[model samples]
Target: MTTEKLFKVNGVELWAETFGDAADPAVLLIHGASASMLWWETAFCAKLAARGRYVIRYDQRDTGRSTTYPVGEPPYAMSDLAADAIGLLDALGVERAHVVAQSMSGGTGLHLGVDHASRVASLTFVSTTTGDDELPPPSDDFPRFSTPDFGDSAAVEEYVVRAIEAESAGVFDEAAARVLVRSDIARATNFEASLTNHYAMKFDGPQGGGFGELTMPVLVVHGSRDPVFPLAHGQALRDAVPGGKLVVIEGAGHGIPEPLWEPFLAALVEQTDAR
Candidate 1:
């Protein structure tokens, strides 16, 4: 079962949902840029909860039912996003949590692990790159996606479906993607803002030290066929953090598709369980 609520953090309202027992170990799921908690499907959260984890998935600022900024003028920086996570934990009465982040939010996780190390138990980064200039650029085959007409719900849903097909290696589910996108558009506070504002935010590096300063257990999850960051990025990310581990999803692209959920879950549970 999932419990949804609103919390006042950093003078803005954030909508969030939680699964399983509050007394269990907590896992905070941060979605990629231009995404809401909907990307972290309910079934996935339920499975994690069944493994004795308290799962939390939320709408970041300008996404889902949370507060929204104007379409092209987001007022907060990326570090503010990291601070919002800490404020959320305080509101939930959780002293420490396992942090799981994907794409752009991976930097946010690094910030928490370095600057706010006391609040995080472990860090799991998915399909993201470390800000290393030496990393190879995105593959030439990377998807060239189109923007949606936000006023037309059908058009927006179709856009999402096309994006999923392009991003996944061979596990795109059109029906499921349509269903999820429809709900996402219908419930979002300002769907257009959610999709556009995140891209404009500036990222300030960790306030303390860098990834090498992280003392918590770090796990990197990447797809074998990821076009954006590629497997090499994941390898380098793991190498940067002390004692970091990498889990590559064979035949997967940038995101964790449904078929690969079990393996990803196993890896996540194992990482979070580490001392």
Candidate 2:
């Protein structure tokens, strides 16, 4: 079924989609930079809902329909982003949740699970990293995306829309892709900028050390075909986190494609429900 839902965090009107029973054990789904809830495969979210788990996927501040950060307010850090996640959980009165994050959001989720274990029941790290040194440079075949010169807002949106529309799923059609990509970049600029500052502040500060503190079960999932963040990052996350299991998808890419949804969700649901 179609879903439209909203919540308030730090007095900001945060938007999200609710799937599954609200009363059931909750799974808080976080997206990567430049992504709203649009990145998730619909079938996967619905399947988790069907299995009696409350799947809450939200628009991080500055993305989707959520409220944007104020102009003069302090820029957001990785901690700030993690705080936003916690704020959402607190706002909903959710004591603990299964946290699933992909790409850049993986770092933020790692911060949360290690620092605030009370809030994370389990962690699913997908196409993600814990800021490890084991990450190799991107391969020659992969398109280098998100450089400092991504061009102006409109240009970046146009490029991203055109690029993602060409993906196999046909999910983000031309028109829909434009709206989602354009709006996401425009709204989330400040928060994303803040994230950049955070990156600079802690560049080489430490790598995934907090994983040693994470006691909860974690499932690290990645795609062999993913060009952006290769399978090595996944392996590193699994290694850093104690007892973490790595599940590699054969044909999957940077984004979780529909072809791998079954295995991804099965692995995700299994780990989330197991412990």
Candidate 3:
């Protein structure tokens, strides 16, 4: 069963959903840029929950039902975003959790492992980079698509489909993508603010310095065909983090398509079980 609720952390209201028994080991899923907890998908969450793990997925501040900032660069730093995750754990009385973070939010997971090590049982990074400037840049073919105006529903739908297709290498369900995009449009209060704030992590510089010090078990999963971050980023992350394991999904792109779900969940469960 899944339960949705709001958590007040650092004076901000974060919307989150919980799955499985509270007594089980916890796993916190952090979505990437311009996405909500919805990005984790119901089937994926349910699968993890069925594995006897407590699953928690939430919208970061300024997205979904969480607190929204005004349109502009956000005032908070990357560390503040990391603190929000810890704050959520505190609210739920969870001392430690296996952290599963995707794309840009992967930085947040690294921060937690470094700054608040005791709160994290393990770490899983997907389709993410170390934020180091020295790493190879994204593929030349990466889509630099622009976000359409929020009021234009048709344009937004097309944009969402294109974005997903670009990330998943045209391996996504069109109907599900449309439903998610429409729901996101309706739920978002300030789409621009959320997007801007989410991407602001780029300005914070590379967060790879402390990876070698994280003692927790770590898993790095990447798509062989990811145009956004690419496979090199995953390789670098696995190399940097001590005892980190890397899994490459052949023919997959940046987005976690249906084919990768089972393997990914097995890896997650294995890592969490190690804790």
Best prediction by lDDT = 1
The global C-alpha lDDT for each of the candidates, from Candidate 1 onward, is 0.91, 0.71, 0.85
* TM-scores for every candidate against the unseen true structure: 0.97, 0.80, 0.94
lDDT of 3 by residue, 121-195 (tens): 999999998867888887788778887886777887788778887788656788888888778877887766666
Most TM-score-accurate candidate: 1
Whole-model lDDT, model 2: 0.71
Clashing pairs in 3: none
Candidate 3 wrong stretches, greater than 4 Å: 201-209
lDDT ranking of the models: 1, 3, 2
Q: Which stretches of candidate 2 lie over 4 Å from their true place?
A: 1-3, 69-74, 145-157, 162-209
Candidate 2 per-residue C-alpha lDDT over 64-87 given as tens digits, one digit per residue, 9 for 90 to 100: 667655433434556667778898
What lDDT is reached at residue 14 by model 2? Answer: 75
Positional deviation of 16 in candidate 3, in angstroms? 0.6
Q: Is candidate 1 or candidate 2 better by lDDT?
A: 1
lDDT of candidate model 1 versus the reference:
0.91
